[model samples]
Target: MNLLHIDSSILGDHSVSRKVSAAAVVAIVAANPGVKVTYRDLDAAPAPHQSGALLAARLLDPGARSADQARDITEADAVLDEFLAADIVVIGAPMYNFGIPSTLKSWIDHLAIAGKTFSYSEAGVQGLAGGKRLILASSRGGFYGADSPMAAVQHQESYLRDFFRFIGIPDVEVVSAEGVNYGPDHKQKALDGAVAEAANLGRALQAA
Candidate 1:
């Protein structure tokens, strides 16, 4: 099995989400002893955002794509290829001001291409990237689950699910640790919950 591990947190050593993500990777690899891991750190190696130049190239055939434009499209295409090749994808994304980081969003934009990830059909949008598992580890400063009053304020999980669903990846799992900045007491509570959840999921994934 091939696993793609992606992290977008800029916190480096102080990042709780990264620690959690690493733990999940360890769990996954342990379960699948022969699983090959590919890591992509968005903060250290950011992907280029799509510009109008690239848009023109995607709309045209390869023969019409300029030398520079073809290179841009080719790079983005490679990332998408890696995404498609992975059997499982684990991502660590810390919430920034109630939304996901721009770097992560940029990577999504590069992958969410028409005729590549999805297509507009007579029935509606048909997603092409299916039959894969996506595990998301998200850290937030506040709670947004059903029991929380601010649950409605969460577009993070919903947006990601919607995007992935649009591309045919509906079997998505999320592990969220919120209230990190609330206080040590609250942070510990959330962290503990997150750790337990990660471990459980890791074991289940490994067994599968």
Candidate 2:
């Protein structure tokens, strides 16, 4: 199986999302034999945001593209291709300002290509990318669950879940560590819950 592991935490070793995601990956690897994993750290190598000039470059012939455009397009295509090739995708998405990291959003921009991931038809929009499992390792500073007071302000997990659904991936498994910034006790509690969830997810996947 091909696994694509993506991390977007800027906090590195101090990142709760990173630790949870790493645990998920390790657990999955242990459960599944011969799984080839491709890892990408978005904080270290950020995805390029889409722009007008970049959009125009796609219309031009390969030979007509300038050096910069060629490089940009190549990088974007690589990101898209990686998403397409993965059987399982593990994402480390940390909440930032009530949403996801900009770097992770930038990476997703490439995957939402018209003909590649989704398309419009007479019947409406149709998603081309499907039959892949998505695991989200989410870290939040505060509680944003349905029972929480701040639930209405949450856009991080909801946004990601909807975005993946748009690409025909409706079944997204989320292992989240919330209230990480609340206190040391809360952080440890949340982290343990998320890690245990990750392990359970791995065992479930292995059984499947």
Candidate 3:
């Protein structure tokens, strides 16, 4: 099986989402021997944001695209290919101002090609990448669950859930560590709990 692991945290070693994501990857490797894993650190090598030049290049014929535009389109195509080839995807997402990192959003933009990942027809929209499994390791400074007072303002998890559903992967599993900035003790407890949850989810994926 091919697993694509993505880390969007800019905090490096201090990132809780990275720690949990790594643990989840290790658990999957342990449970399913010989699984191939591809890791992409969005902070280290961020995807370029969409631009008019890029959009025009995509709309133009291959021979008409400028050299730079062609290169950009090629890179975007590579990103889409990687996602399409993956049987499972794991993302480490940290909430920034109640939303996902811009770097991660750029990567999503690369994968959200209309005719590649999805298409519209008489039956409405059809998601081509429907069978892939998605696991998200999320970290937040404050609680944002349904029971939290700030649930309505939460966008990180909700946005990801919607994005995945739009691509036809509706059954996304998220392991989140919330209230990490509350206090040192609370941070430790939340991190530990999220790590454990990631491991359990990894094992469940192996079983599935």
TM-scores of the models, in the given order?
Answer: 0.89, 0.96, 0.94
lDDT of each residue in 51-165, candidate 2, tens digit only: 9999999999999999999999999999998999999999999999999999999999999989999999999988889999999999999999989999999999999999999
Best by TM-score: 2
Colliding pairs, model 2 = none
Task: Give Cα-based local distance difference scores for all models.
Answer: 0.84, 0.92, 0.91
Whichever of 2 and 3 has more lDDT, that candidate is 2
In candidate 1, which residue pairs clash? none
Task: Enumerate clash totals for all models, in the order shown.
Answer: 0, 0, 0
lDDT of 1 by residue, 1-208 (tens): 8898989999997787787778788888888888989999999987767778667778998898888888777778877888989888888988887678898998899788789889997899999989788888889988788788988878777788899999999978988898899989988888788877876787678534
The 10-residue segment of model 1 with minimum total lDDT is 199-208
Model 1 regions lying over 4 Å from their true place:
56-71
TM-score comparison, 1 vs 3, better candidate: 3
lDDT of 3 by residue, 115-182 (tens): 88888999998877889989999999999999998999999999999988888899999999999999
Candidate with better lDDT, 1 vs 2: 2
